[model samples]
Target: MSMNLIEKDRVATINPLKTCQPLGAMWAVTGISRAVPLVHGSQGCSAFVRYCLSRHFREPSEIAVTSLHEDAAVFGGRKNLVEGIQNVAIRLKPDFIGVITTCSSEIIGDDVIGFIKTAKGELKEKIGEEAVEKIKIIPISTPSFVETHLKGYDNTIKALADYVAEPSQPNEKINIIPGMVNPGDIREIKHMLRLMDIESIVLADISDPFDAPLRPSTTEYKPYYPKGGTTVDEIVDSANSVGTISLTKYAGSGALSLEKKYNVPAELGPIPIGVRNTDQFLRNLKKLTGQDIPDSILDERGLLIDSMADVASRYLFDKTVAIYGDPEITSGIARFVGELGMEPKLVLTGSKSQEFVKDIEKVAKETGAEIDTMIDQDLRSMEVYLKDNPVDLMIGGSDARLMAKENDIPLVRVGYPVYDRVGYHRRPIVGYNGGIQLMDLITNTVLEKYYEPEHWKLQQ
Candidate 1:
């Protein structure tokens, strides 16, 4: 909310908390089986998204684009979008098609929704009524100038739920709206739900898709999309769930939309980063499912506590941390850090969201810790702040890694675009078990710093 804070630097490139919007769209659509995402803009946008996804998921991500050229840009790309959708439908024969507009299309004021309608009409005519009934097309407008990738992802998920969730008789199932999390985290959430004996539906679940097993004896790996993502039928039947659990506040928007349309109730909570947040998520699950917390979860929580206790005297108390990422992620990390008896000195998010300040304030109030919260913050401002007053550690995306290295502060990679490291797609950072993993990572990162060469004496 501090406008002056962002204006401090006009031309400094720092670690960004956010990424491009088209990438977010790609990530979102990856959750759908046989769902081809058609980028309604330049070929570069589609190519860049595919590259990033391939790096993160370690699989070939096939996304179609209108491949806008000079003529399309000047005359408007409506024709390109229409033709692109038709071609993707014919070749891929996907159950659903997601059309996301890029900056180029938005700038030209191309009516994506209208084009989708027209495309649908054309498909109906070509495929006949019966075949048309099998296919669904969803359009989403993602203007990068208006919001970051987080918002774009949120919007895409909301649009999916709106278009796919059907009116059905209620069933004994829970809808799990996991925000933009890695495949590992999604799997962990499903595991926790299974342990609780709660049947749940996770929209766009990509645990298997992004982290499939490697085929031996050959360097060629099969594409992941065909195997991963929630099925279109499952999404349409999500309305049958008893209630919804949203892992992050941003994902709650999609849950809210589902609730409004189908009268399904939703439980909104932060992403389970640290022990306390994970505990909160589990407790909510217990309440919603009318089931008791399993002893296994309790044991996991105990192990996390024991791990922290082993290093509690070392640095748990009076530890200062700086965090930057998506707004919801910043809030979740802030809550988790605060609960660990650490001071979250600086919290920054590139994306602007409603209740961001309120969410941070609530976490600070709950943990009795004061935090400096910033929204719409760029990496330049974050770097400036770090230069002026640094902390013991930083938690964010890959961008923060560089700042941490430069300042000699250890970095905990927590959010999206974790480009430098592998297995980020499968790292679990949610639920009880994930809490244990996170505690170990943080404790080890701190201990690694403690036992550095400078702190040790030369051996005889």
Candidate 2:
């Protein structure tokens, strides 16, 4: 059984793990083809969001801001909103502009939907009705004070479903909602779908846009937006897909919306990070498309199992770890560590989700490992907990780097905002290959710190 700790009363959180909503909204918008995220707030807000994303992905994150000032805050931001849309629509010429609200506009209670309508009409006059109609301006409300970035991503996706998706000609394709995952993870999921020969429309697919290779400017072409994302056409047609699979519970509102509006079957998540979770994903796909699991995938699974067996006793078994990150990702990793015969002593996340506790408890019961779980907590809390009850390793985002260093524990970086390291955005951590990579990383991290020269010699 797991001892789930509720967050104690505090005036404020220290070293809070999650970022704000607009960042998540901006991230989602980047996954749309030729889409630009227009922050409906101050320039500083947009800059922070862009800086955070650019640092993590190691790419130029393009974002626009309304540049709201004192006057706009006191009165209203309708003028700024209309002009921002017009400028972005004309200058950037983006197919979609996600107008994401921040605390400033949200707190003032700006009528964003109405302002968008007004902006559209004004754009019809400036850029012509035909051109204005071509660009879709979706308003996403994301108050930073209310929820974390995960909700921002969820809200943006749901807004897309509400405004864009339509019942159209039927298609055999299924919709995949990959929540807050790296580009490499998205590639892995796509690869698996390709192997299964199942056609899929991955909503907010950021793989190419985020991890795009550097291409020198040529006379023939110069890059603006990188060459990948879910096209607006694909999103509209998503309503007619056979089914929708949301890879994480944190960002499944869009899938749920599609199911409710268009009667599309929806499978909400346990993101496919670990073996059992991946199996569940495959099972869901099979149930939807009647496709059998191919031997190639089975071979990958076999390799993972064989590797686990080989390392279970020597380096992995009975190890203690502290896992923390986004709720769904943390839970999935906790489950995976259990599969690796590692006991997750403490699982913590800054996000407020009761489901996180339930999932951790389920993992504890399944693994027969006594665990301690914390939700809506910060790194400061995790550091305190680790001080009293030390663990062998810590699995989390780059934010935990300091804590791990102080505690002298090996940190296995996973999940979002890993700004301190590069190539993580380019590496898969979801599929069987991801399993092997993570297993190797965890084992090697431990061996590097704890194993002696004699231990290696004996093994040889």
Candidate 3:
């Protein structure tokens, strides 16, 4: 078994592994239909977020800023926030406005909740009671200094559940909370649901909004917003679902909230990234809905196992790999590589969680590899460690490119903010199909790095 180390007393950081919390909150809001994320802080904060999101998704990401001035910082940001919401509602006309608090706003102790209540009254007066009631204004507290982006996403999801969900007669549908994953992952989960003929309400479904299809129209009739996302009605109706399944442990707060409040059975994650994990997810579905595992899914699983068996002795078995990303994804990938008969040398994440340590330990026992786990550490630490004890390959977000380049190891890109390459968001690393793709990706990377030059001599 490996040591799960929580690096301590680090005064300085270089290239931290995670982004700020507000960005996460903004991302969650983007997954909702006709929703606008309004940052209750300076223009620079909002601009930075917009740039990061646009670069990653390669889409026109929209965000509104309160433009808090010096006066507002000293006294209060109530006036700026109210005006900002009014302008966004009247001009942009979004159905939902997620007011996200930044470091500046939170530090000043702004009463954002009170301000939102006040804004509702003012909105009723300005844009009629009926029209104003149609819009939902939810306030999300995301002070960046206190937490990572993962928490921001989780907090926003919980906020959505708290504000929108209303318990009624139970429905035949299940609620799927896909946490902090790519659009492709969500799409794959939806496909699995379809295969099972199970009805589901996916909370914060960003499959359509983030990876939108291009449509040509006249200049006068262009579509301003991408036609995608989980509707408000669906979110409200989620309370009546038979059960809720959260794909990521880090972002399962909403699922837990629903279970506690509305008695909805909640299945917290193993994040169906590998063969076994996917099996667990499907089994959970079968248990909850009394649906048998279909032949199609079984066939897919068989194919994945066949491929792994074919490649294990030559390409994948006993290879060493280091993975870093969000805690859940990192753990999931570690487990997948372990399942492929690979030794996971190091697994690291920026987020601080004891659950991550436990997960890694479990993986270590299952795989029987002495894995070195790092939590709440930056890439600089990872880079420093790799100088002495290098792995055969690295798997993480695009930010780990520098570490891979330095160590002369192949890198398999996955998880959030994969800005260096396009379509990473469009290809999943979840489900049975995702297992096949990931196995191919890893095997190909290994062959390309070590055996590609000798390929011409081999007979097909």
Best by TM-score: 2
lDDT of each residue in 1-460, candidate 1, tens digit only: 1211233345443555677777777787878877888898899989988887787677777788999988887899988988888888776678888888888998898988888888878877776767667877888778876777877787887887788889678778888878888888888998878788888788777676667665554434334245667888888888778788888786577789888988887888778777777878877787777878888878878887787676655556768888888776678778777767777888888776647877877777777766777776787777778888778888877766666888899998876778788776677877767766766777678767755654334222
Cα displacement (Å) at residue 41, model 2 = 0.6
What TM-score would each prediction reach against the true structure? 0.91, 0.98, 0.97
Off by over 4 Å in 3: 4-6, 218-222, 455-460
- How high is the lDDT of residue 109 in model 2? 94
Backbone Cα, N, C clashes tallied per candidate = 0, 0, 0
lDDT value for candidate 2?
0.89
Clashing pairs in 2: none
Prediction 1 global C-alpha lDDT: 0.77
Assess each prediction's global lDDT (C-alpha) against the native. Answer: 0.77, 0.89, 0.89
Which residue pairs overlap in candidate 3's backbone? none
Model 2: weakest 10-residue lDDT segment is 1-10
Candidate 2 shows a clash count of: 0
How many angstroms is residue 408 displaced in model 1 relative to the true structure, after the best TM-score fit?
Answer: 1.5
lDDT for 370 (candidate 3): 90
> If the candidates were sorted by their TM-score against the true structure, best first, what order would they fall in?
2, 3, 1
Error of 3 at 148 (Å): 0.8
Q: Which of candidates 1 and 3 reaches a greater lDDT?
A: 3
